[model samples]
Target: MSIENTLSEIRDINLNYLMLAQQMIREDKPSAIFRLGISKDIANLIDSLSNSQLTKLANAQMMLARFRFDDCSILNMLTSYNKDSALTNAHAVMLMANQPVEAIA
Candidate 1:
């Protein structure tokens, strides 16, 4: 895909992720922190952002859509022998982000 298209897709994903994080914070702050793997301070910062701020951040096209495991060994440990389990976990993340899991793969 063209770079512009890729960037647009990233922006859309970022917006959706931010919006879901915002809702999770409002509904269940602790759960949001746990699920997002974010510190309370970061969660509070996310919670404090207005929708406009979120939109601006999304438009910046620098937000991440998924976490990258730092260690290859960790990734292997998590998904080496159980592909189904890995897929289920990924689907759960999509659900949490309010995205259709099927749309992902």
Candidate 2:
């Protein structure tokens, strides 16, 4: 199957879940509250996302939480990992900037 088809299906399913979550939120359904953009049968992808993808997701989540949630919350699988990866990236950059670059022949 093509990537497009796979994504198209995932998108449809994700939308269904999003709607379900919204309805759940309004109906005071705890399960629905956590359903938005989240898959029920979550995949085990602890370090699957590339470094760039990980950083991007974390940044997106951080920005989303600033106005949406009271604080930066890590509720889902990708949440905590993204945030941690972003922090590590930041630290690595800082450490690199602080060090002197040696000239290579």
Candidate 3:
């Protein structure tokens, strides 16, 4: 694919991610903060963004959302299939819960 197409796709993804994040934050502040792995300040910033601001931010070439889990083990646990899905998911959540939330620089 062309670079322009790739950039357009990235922008679309960013817009969708931002919209969903804003909804999540508005509906449930604490849950959104934990799920997004972001600090309360960042969540507030996201929540306060206007539609034009969101579009402007989303137009950036780079992605806005990112994987919260940096550890291979956690990633593997989430991706791997297991017969005991419930237990595995619970374990993964426990590990993720221990991870530090992303703070605004």
Tens digit of lDDT per residue, candidate 3, span 1-105? 999999999999999999999999999999999888889999999999999999999998898888878899998998899999889999999999898988755
How high is the lDDT of residue 97 in model 2? 38
Runs in model 1 deviating more than 4 A are 65-68, 82-105
Q: After superposition, how far is residue 92 of candidate 2 from its true place, in Å?
A: 40
lDDT of each: 0.73, 0.39, 0.93
Query: Taking the tens digit of each residue's C-alpha lDDT, what string does model 1 give over 1-105?
Result: 999999999899999999998899989999887677676777887899998999998897575556545445455655566759767566545544452222112
Rank order (by lDDT, best first): 3, 1, 2
Among all windows of ten consecutive residues in candidate 2, which has the lowest summed lDDT? 61-70
lDDT tens digits, residue span 1-105, model 2: 996666566555544433444455556434432423232222113124444543444432112221122223322322445647867656544543344422212
Model 3 clash pairs? none
Residue pairs with backbone atoms closer than 3 Å in model 1 (clashes): none
Please report the candidate that would top TM-score against the real structure.
Answer: 3
Q: Candidate 3 vs. truth: CA RMSD? A: 1.1
The TM-score between candidate 1 and the true structure equals 0.68
